[model samples]
Target: MSVFIEKKKRLSNDSISQLEDELEDNPLDYNKWIKLIKQVMVKDKEEQIRNVFTKYLDIFKLDGEQWCKYINFEIGKGDFKKVEELFAKCITTVDNVELFRLYVSYVRRVNDVITGGEKARSTVISAFEFSVNRVGIDVKSGELWNDYSEFLKSWTPSQSWEKQQKIDLIRKLYKKLLVIPTEKVESMWSTYTKWENEVNSSTASRFIADKSAEFMEARAWNIEWNNITDKSLSRKVLPYGLDDSDKDNRKEIEQQLQYWYKWIEFESRNNLNLKDDDLLNKRIEYVYKQAIVSLPFVPELWYRYNQFLMNGPSTEDSNSLNMNIDILSQGLILNPKSYLLSFQLSELYEKETNLAKANEVINNLVNKLIQDHSQIIKQIEEINDKSIVKTQNINGDADNMDEDDVNKPKPGYFLSEHDIKSLKDLKLTEKELSRNITLVYTKLMMTNKRSSGIKESRQIFKQAKKFANIGFELYVENALMEYYSDNKKTANKVFELGLKTYGTNGKYLLAYLDYLIMVNEIESIKVLFEVSITNLLKEIEDPEGVDDMDTPVWIKNENLEKINNHKYFIKRLIKKYGKFATKFLDLGIVTSLEKRFKKYFPEDDELELFRSRYSYDSIDLIKYDLGKSVKYIEQDTRGDIDQFFDYDDETFDKNKRRKLDLPSKPKETAVANQPVIETQNGFIGESIYNLLRILPSASYYGNVEDHVFNSKKLVELFNSLDDIRNQ
Candidate 1:
């Protein structure tokens, strides 16, 4: 409540009021009066001042700066009408044609935001008319003409407008300036072209092109020819008798030639709606002419010409093919080591499937290697003699060997692993084809006993593995060879070792998984499953080092910060295998089968039986359970229990039915009439094996029940057996 002191700034309202009265009579006194009026008006008086300005819009001839000030201030107030009025007043100012255009443009821009119809259209049209007729204006004022034209176009059309009428309007506006000074026309042509392109109407582009051509021609052709070709100005001549000072002139002509050549190339490439025969003929002629004109001896053009003639009706004309080959040969002579020419000749022969000549070229390359590695060949031949001696002792005389004996190679003694590796490197030394060598190794394995040697197998695996490193398909075959040669357990161990060493890179990951599945290595399969799941979780959560999410198997992560900070890993786990795999795990189906097989078939060697030849209907599981339960019946007997345990396709008891039809049998006799049983361990084991033979392959994995709808048959079969026991 203490006394509040206020300091006041002095103002001359009396002077401002007098000037305002003068402005009211003739508001065009903008330069002398407007700035002073604005200085005295407080922020609160903005609306009152805007009202006065709007009322006097027609009478004012404000300078562009003062007028622009009012328009911008009014726009900030959202009083678009006042902005348009002030903009109109500004453009009508006599001087500062550039400023007039700039202010008018600002007005149209604001009008576009808030006004439509005849008011906006007429305002823009007025600006265009002023800009086109103005002299000594900024070059960019012509650009304002374009903006005004667009604003006028947006008006609701009169009923008189036809397709051609709208086109002519744009044409007439553009043509008005077409006859303007050439320098100005040239400067404005680019702006006009830009405006013309933005218009969607079809006729606009053609109209712009015609007008631009007219403007360029007026500027370019108006000069006398001697101005461009005055070569007497040169100071010296080069050895070719061309003037050094005229170099720039010659370059200009060359540029023109290049420009025309580019257009020809474009037309030839697009061929838009041209007829097939015409297009072909036109393209061929262009290529042929281009070859003759530019660097006349270029080889690519010659090849293209040859391709065209052969592809056309003149293919049978051997003359053109021979001519192209001659050109290629000449080029080769100049550039002797050109790989492209050599490859082309090889391809031409190969395309005809003329393998003999292809072999001849390939053999020449291989023969060079043989000459270089004569010592290695001698050692390889000596190794073969030792292998043949060992094989001959095993098979008795070689003459009586199996029919496939001819397919077997005479075995070579690889005295050491180094010898095999040395032979493999010989091909690379002479630059012989490596891929064909892999194929040859494949044939040697299939056809020759020499392939059975352990050192030799290791050597082949090494070469195949090298090719696989480069992504060849032959590595899978080599992995299969290693798999089949050993105890199944050892093969699984080797592959597992390989996987650990290889880091489970994606390509090798797929190959390794495929091999495990083929050989029924379930334990290794489970390990891989865990590895893949862990990889998915780490990638989805932190994603720091994962590569190439573009692979089809991967999905890119969005929302990096959220993914890293949150636990979205469970969702990733569910997504990886889909719901079905999760369901199997949750229901304990997989665990139960693994446990049951190991428990009941403890000593069985055919652990892979579950995976082999497994086909069954829903009823088969019941039969399997019945077969397993009755297996014990043969175990406690002493007579040959083999028949009881030995199973095959189920047979009906024909003799039992025949006896029933004949007469009723006494109980004592029936008990005594049962067949004698056997009890030796070997006999019992053999019978158990026989029983297994008839049980479909699936009975091995406890998958028998899955074959019958999640073991519904097992339940039924168990219940029926319990009923019989109770009776």
Candidate 2:
């Protein structure tokens, strides 16, 4: 080998040694031992391989994979005696069906290769017998039985008497397998029938009798399969093997149901020609009925039963419809509160156009709701009475007690007090219950076609209002009915009632506003908008007061909903009215509201943006005062005039000593003319300079007069002044 190959081999050997050391410390490391054995096998170390297999099997004897590796290794060595020995040992140590299978396969190979006559045949039969004894009772041991029967078929006898004996033995094994309740029992029966037909071709009478018996036995096997599955369903577990504690029991039951379903499907698939279609459907229906009878509380089984009935051959028959109805009705009796069963019943009635029955079912449900609501109200009243009594007792006791006794800290006082307060507050009032009951009653009456006229509907609304004076939904529903009936005036009245009762309700506010908008009532729309904005802001400001009448547990959630509703309404108004919405944005109130909202709800980005959109800067307009006179013009002009006076050059140098003061007229004339000319020029220059300065800085203001116009005018004035000064 090359030097590199030698190095690679040495490294693999080193790794094998390290792994072996690890296995010595932790012999249960099955994977490491497997890896080490693989490495040793690569080096072709026969003795090391044997030693590794021996050690691993001795440690992990119950592990099927280890036994398989050992058996496979022994078989590869072509040592029949060693393979047989390993099979015997594995069968005793491992309780795995695959190991038994491997053992049977090895025995068959040996019989084929060595042709050990009766001795090898006996070995194979013994292997089969051992496996049968070990795993024959397991429901999943169909493969083992299959392999055994196939092995017997593959084995041939040398003498006629021996052939008869072998045939009898195979028949006996088949009969024995027939008693085991497994999914593959039917296939086994088929196999047995085929074998008997080939074997007894000459004995016609005996073959017919035997086939008839086998057919009876097959029917018995089917019944036994049903019984086995039924028992498993009853136990809520699998029929064979150790129960898996980690698996869900419900899933196990579902799996058992699926098994039966599959068995029925198998019978249907295979016996299509042999069995009558009606008989097959009846058999499947019988099994489904048995299942529902056993697990009537399971809605899934009921649904499956309904599906079977609907899709069955008799689906269009009257009896099938009645049967489906009876099944669902029975299911409802088992679980009266099951909405699925109730809905199914309603659908069945509607399908048949049994309007009376459908109405009756709906009436029953409505009555149930009313009774439930009444019971709840009574319970709430009892709790409130108890709370009131407790409060009275506490107050009376406090009055009789000393100051210290009354003020002393008590354990659980806060918790008990809170519980009492919650019990008192968390109740649907009589008005609320009456409101719901009225709506349900109206629905029941209308559903039966007993009340169809507008007058009847109006009477129903009036009765509902009498019961619940301030029910918001009742008001809205009444208004909607009137509006839909073209009773516009009544609808407006109902809407106003709803607004008066539930001013903070965004739905009512929006509905009334929409109606106003539809009527072209702009003033009413404005009023509604203002009222909604005020109520929403008020609710947000004092959420505690707003939610006091609601459930205490939902107070925070109600507050959040109110904030969201506020945001929603504000956005709607802005989207609909645009500039008209600016009238609602009060700076002082909104700023304070924003501060409070931030303190309580800092994460409300929508509300934050709403606040920022209407802040002072967002609305304030900037004005530039370019028309104002300049302040420093007089001072600049005086400095320019003084510069003109301070001038005098060579002529002044000669006249400086002539009189030390020139003639008064010339001096006065010079002074007079200089002031006039310089002052005029200075004023024009200052005006142009100031206008240029103002033009650049004018953009700081929000509404500077048109820049283009100002620029043109200033340029024109400056050019005219320049022309005048040049002349």
Candidate 3:
């Protein structure tokens, strides 16, 4: 309490420590990713450095700039195998132009005509083709196309067949590039025209004439593309780091996102009437890649892109489904917090009848939710003070006084040991998060039902109950599933279970009462009233003169509100039913079926004049906007919901049901779930497997498992061959 000079505390001056501290506060900060990488690069321990890189890349896997930095670091180390491994991990997900340039650069570095000869030249050509196939459609992919052209022109052949082959390859590459509406297509068209004339004077006219119409069309679009993207700034506009305090930058970022979205609309033919769906989808898909490369952290863009791909004319194409899966998976890596991408991916897998993978997507999402909730709870515990509790934002600074209010010493109020436990768990307080988890649980149950029947769905329900943060909706949904299955006893039991936990919850109570009324269960409804009222009565009285009770005003109000909600519900019930329908209706002087309403809430006309009105006959019904109705279970391969998993008694084999283990991060689960491939040296799962083998990563680079130059096993084989040659 003494007004003395306070000793200044100091922070560690170490750069790595400093960066780590900042990253802990905001992990998605792009600048920090760069600075931290640069800082760690100067260090000698490869393993430690690799660990740090992996840690960040797990979150920012689609960020092309960061991927290149890691790839370049590996290239400098001369670990070609490691470099390929790193590329494999990144190549599948990220569709960045910069990353492709690095890929080609590495190709040129290791495989050159001077030392490595024709085979190396062929390899380089293959690499360029692979890179061009995935990203050549991009407007910003001008440089990569140019590089590929330069490499082709640099080659000369010793044979007649080779000369013709080279010429044909050049024509093919030029024809492809000239028709694409990229930024540098016009310049390339000019160069191609000149080269065609130089190659064969007689056929140059025909070659030039063949592509002229398409070339002109592409050239017009490229100019129009530049018009739509005035001073085109998608690359320079970095997001994920700007704070609310930096208002100008935040505004700029928002504007940039809007601009990109508008550009996407333009590409998608929102303004233009491009009668060709195939050409339109391609253009839209290309723009989506460009936008995604620039704004990897935005989940909405990924989701929108997936929707476009799924709904477009391309859906009839065999590859569309795989394309959707790959896009959604990449989005999941960057934005694990987003529920949209996960739900979509899970549904897609379900559509494909891959039930295990469908469940895994949801399982992974719930796991992420748990991990995130745990982190939030830990942060709250660390920041929560014994005496002083910040009244506004829990995570904000305690000193909340304005400039003029500096004289006001007390910024926060006081808290007691008992008052700290939230009326609900801290985890459940995140309402949006809780709602998403509940939807996931419902989706999980639906998936289980579709696969193994109601027996499995019930198992999933039990697992969902283990999480404290899930909403009453899961119980509501589970009860409906049983009710729809014509298992009245099981449905009633599920409702009773829900009421026991959420006894005072007005929404769940109303829904339960409605179902009871719908089913004409008068006796069971009476039992519900008796059981639910017992616990709710404890908090029915208002607290005014009570002392030493440091109960926050909100909790007291909540209690009053709950009691009033029950009163209003009974009011609605009495309005529907007769006043003397039962003992509760007949005996009570309040003239209602609400048992203790007169005694507990005495009628007072004299005190009716409230300074603040109690307001509203409205009772909140808990509704999460689930796009798909949970109660509607359609026909599956097994059978209809009516015939699926029928139970005779009040029992199913609990032992027969599969257990969903608490999951790790999605990426970790992916690696750990890979099955062991049997080999001559017994069975061993390849530990070095990366997501690059994922089909979606390289749209054009079809099934490039590994290059021999980047394999240690191949290097050993090469050394042995050299030894044989020397002998």
Candidate 4:
């Protein structure tokens, strides 16, 4: 491998080497893998080709098309055994109808039904059965269902009893297919009814009667599916990456996620109007399964699905817990490093009272993360490529360089496939992975705490601290545990230790301050609050001062933290140190802090009470107005070059010098309203339509330009808007 890489370094434009180099940097790039595979195929080196395909499929286990590609590659080379092997592996790992279809296709090709024995026919039958058993629940799998039914119909027997059995089997299959709540169900119903009538009128009538309810349900499914399922949504679940700045792509991804949520809700809410709880549960589980197939790397879905199965109407105790374990375990396989999935899987085991298994699950995650963390971090540093040098092409000019810097490739010029998997299933960056590692450590600590006790948890926390690469949550969690265990001294010590490590981080400082407040460490709280605020402010690179700087989200968050810290301190110390509160939470600072955040709160009850308590300002209405309008008022203060909007109260259009006379009338009783809008209760909706009919319209007395703006309709619209605002 070293020699191969060394050889590649001398070949600047070698496609194979370049592709391999790119793949080494980002193994998850599917396009790169395809390019590499195509290049490899040119050489016809079967082993190397197989190796590449193996790695590709291993990463994208859910991609049935890729599996088909591999199988096709083998089949093209007349390697039937390899094709069969590939099909077996794909069928076991992937729940994809296309993959199953491909396998069925292969089975038919290999075993010629015309000349082959009963074994060949049996193989074909089994293939169809297996395909349906696995992926027949997919609503979009209309093609697969049609193919299976048609395939089964093709088989006919001559013996009287055998023919009857075949008819019975086909009837059973059709009946099952008809009720599956797929779009195909409509066509399936038509076919089933036709086939039944063809066989016998009496049998068809009875069969149709028995299936009327299911047929109705399937019809409802069709309607809901049509409404909810966006055909534009690509169900292809590839492990990919995303660029955060790509807002359009992000919106598309969010829309896809919402579509899945709708599908899940539709199933779980008895949207099909199913009478049976068991049927609803089955359908809900089916939707979750389909979602997982499309988003296997999404840990949250797995967690939610597991929770659904582990509790509520869907749960079945041991069965539910085991099911949760299986689902979560599968999620962990796809999202190998997902802390959330790992934690939940362990939680399931713990719930089962399998302490050893629970410990094993968390321990396994921590161990794997530990093994890969350093390497992943190292790869990131390499990807950063600090040694990059700007140069002129071929000319070797130092100062005179290519002008196409905008198109110049960076270290990560290619979109990361892992990110596209979220392209939230996308690969986590070094910082993100580090956070997950910390989370995993916390989970491990918790697992041990639950199973072993505080002593073990403390030791685990000590080890976590030694790692020193984690965030403050490790310390906070441990300290709180100690505090809750009636060891305030130990907890305080833990906090003090973390203070040295994370004093500058606003989050840690706030957490530490909260601890101080909870314990009523008055003097310590004062010192820590001052120290924390100072450290946090200094931590932000605000040498020019924060007052004039453009506050980005991160900066706003820091300032928000500062305000929260102040609020915590003031709320605790307000009565005894009202003057101190006034000094820190002074009007200007409070206004600036609040300007960055607005929860759209209904009212300021606390602020009103505080104002009532203190005679700080007599002009309460003016204060309130300023507070509400601060966002607009602070756009820019009076400066020589600053722009401001000046307005006059007597503003009017010269064209509308004459005010138009408009008729006004009181609202009439329901009897006088339009019959369309009238009811026993009262007139429904706006009633403007009927009111306009009754009020009458006056013509063209104003300037044509002012006509639309000054009309009664405009007045009504303004009134409606005012009503909304008042509400």
Q: All candidates' lDDT scores?
A: 0.45, 0.60, 0.68, 0.65
Cα deviation at 392, candidate 2, in Å, is 1.9
lDDT of candidate model 1 versus the reference: 0.45
Clashing pairs in 3: 92-697
- TM-score for candidate 3, please give it: 0.63
- For residue 105, model 4's alpha carbon misses the true position, in angstroms, by 3.9
Deviation in Å, model 4, residue 16 alpha carbon? 4.2
Q: In model 2, which range of ten residues has the least summed lDDT?
A: 620-629
Model 1 lDDT per residue over 636-656, tens place: 334443333322233312111
Please report the candidate that would top TM-score against the real structure.
3
For model 1, give the 10-residue run with minimal summed lDDT.
654-663
User: In model 4, what is the error at residue 434, expressed in angstroms?
Assistant: 7.4
- The segments of candidate 4 whose C-alpha lies over 4 angstroms from its true place after superposition are 1-12, 34-44, 75-84, 106-123, 189-216, 238-245, 271-279, 312-323, 333-339, 349-443, 467-473, 499-517, 520-727
TM-scores for every candidate against the unseen true structure: 0.21, 0.39, 0.63, 0.62
Give per-residue CA lDDT, model 3, range 286-346, as digits (tens).
Answer: 7777777677666778888898788876586758899899889977876766778888998
Tens digits of per-residue lDDT for model 4, 452-546:
88998877787776664787888898888889888999999999998998876656776887687678776886688667655644544343223
Candidate 2 Cα errors over 4 Å, as ranges: 1-232, 235-288, 298-304, 307-318, 350-354, 397-531, 540-727
* Full candidate order by TM-score, most accurate first: 3, 4, 2, 1
